[model samples]
Target: MTPLRQRMLEDMSIRNLATNTQMSYVQQVAAYAKYFRRPPQELGPEDIRTYQLYLLETRKLAPSSIGLATGALRFLYKVTLKQPWAVEEIPMPKRPFKLPVILSREEVMHFLEAVSSLKHRTLLTAIYAAGLRVSEATHLKITDIDSQRMMLRVDQGKGQKDRYVMLSPRLLDTLRLYWKAARPTLWLFPGDLPDQPITRDAVGQACQKAHRASGIAKPITPHSLRHAFATHLLEAGTNVRTIQLLLGHRSLATTSRYLKVASSTVCATTSPFDLLPKVEEPPPLTPTPPAHF
Candidate 1:
């Protein structure tokens, strides 16, 4: 069992999975083993399928939860156990399509203004300004900001891919002020502990507090700021491919969802009724046609 755990960790490390992902997968696999009261290696495809059903039907788990468990089990069987056929019978649940919640520009400003702590405010603003995930913002280093290039280097972003995002002059100035005030030694947004980066929970709590204070009503969150960022860029006429690159999205489809959130795209053309001039019905035209006939 210990050897199996070691192999799984090594494989995850090689794939450069994020720390949070690694922990989640580890926990999922452990839970599977505990459920069966035996090592995961001893479980067959039938057992895996049964457990998934139990999660969905009896436990009333969400599709996302089932997906995560399926992924972790698949990785264990295929990657760690070197048994690709073991998970053949397990099926992935269909995830429902839902549009991401986005905040208006004014709401975003209010949310930021409601944040009382300089560190928290700056960090959330950076996430929105740079279109960064909370993890990416938390892990940012001082050297990552390139004012000359007008880009911010996001090292080891989602899927362990490093990419560059545009830097707004406004955001850069705000960051400068934040840096001077915070005087963080290493991580740009270091936590109270010297060496540790700020936890995602802390960022989330700040967002929740800000949301309550602002009373914006819309479901505002840290990620909603990111959605607002992308949507605003699309509204400003930034192309989809360019946004894909900026947001570090691997697929064009993922970035294209911003089209739904962008007001410009939806509001570009006026209704046909509004284009026509108001006039009384042309009853005279009918009588004129009969006379010509």
Candidate 2:
């Protein structure tokens, strides 16, 4: 490795950044350098601005994507090079507010029913039944399943926080069948290679095929099942804070975003019209005479 790249990676490692984050930072910085045909160390803020424009106008990257690139550049200059430029100079784009896609109980059933393979169906069922992140569900080990306590242990989730999610009886039964069939040694859902968990891509493809077969027009993904899980719970009278713990969300606000998409919450709420007291209808309202007329 080059002295510069090594130093940056060391800095990131020292901070205990996740492997995915480190790779993303390195790649973004490398892309920036490559675009200008010069090492990142040789470039100035103006060059960074130019690259940001390219990402915005020419490449048309999403705000989150652009923000990730900016984060990488910030790390390279502020942490690695110890440059004098302010971190704020590398501005992030404004994040858009988009509600997550949620499926109804019947819709979820239809979608799950479409999966041809028993293994694939069970994998997805675990995710939806437990409200698991795609990554967390994929990484689950055999030991993580506690049928006695009816809880699923999720180790090192997105923020490296380990938490326990409820394991429904129905899910447990499905998992037991899968265990009996597959006889997995390590990962609950092992990949083709020994000891490796099934790829997120495989789970995604399963959802896509199911989505098509089920004839649900709305976009469906592995994460969509998670949304359906939370929404279905809220509809069933589960508390937001309870759902927060179940979903392993760091902030209540993040969990509360589901409120926007939760049909139960919106539909259950009484309208302003309902708040008004019962009244007799006026005998035929006389047409109001306009002052000008």
Best by lDDT: 2
Candidate 1 structure quality by residue, lDDT tens digits, 1-293: 48888899999999978887888999999999998999988888889989998899998999999999999988899889888685676788999989998888898898999999999999999999999999999999888999999889999999889999989999999999999998887888998797999999999998899889998888977889889999988998888898889889989999998887678977777989988999777666444454563
- Which runs in model 2 stand beyond 4 Å of their true positions? 272-293
Best by TM-score: 2
Give each model a TM-score: 0.89, 0.91
Evaluate model 1: give its lDDT.
0.89
Error of 2 at 71 (Å): 1.2
With a 3 Å backbone cut-off (N, CA, C), the pairs that clash in candidate 1 are none
Alpha carbon deviation, residue 181, candidate 1 (Å): 1.5
lDDT of 2 by residue, 1-293 (tens): 78998999999999989888999999998898889999987998888899999999999999899999999999999999988784867777799999987888999899999999887899889889999999998999999999889999999998888999999999999999999998999999888896789999998888888888999988999998999999889888899999999999989999998888887777878899999999998799789988883
| RMSD of candidates 1 onward, in order | 7.1, 4.6
Stretches of candidate 1 off by over 4 Å are: 270-293
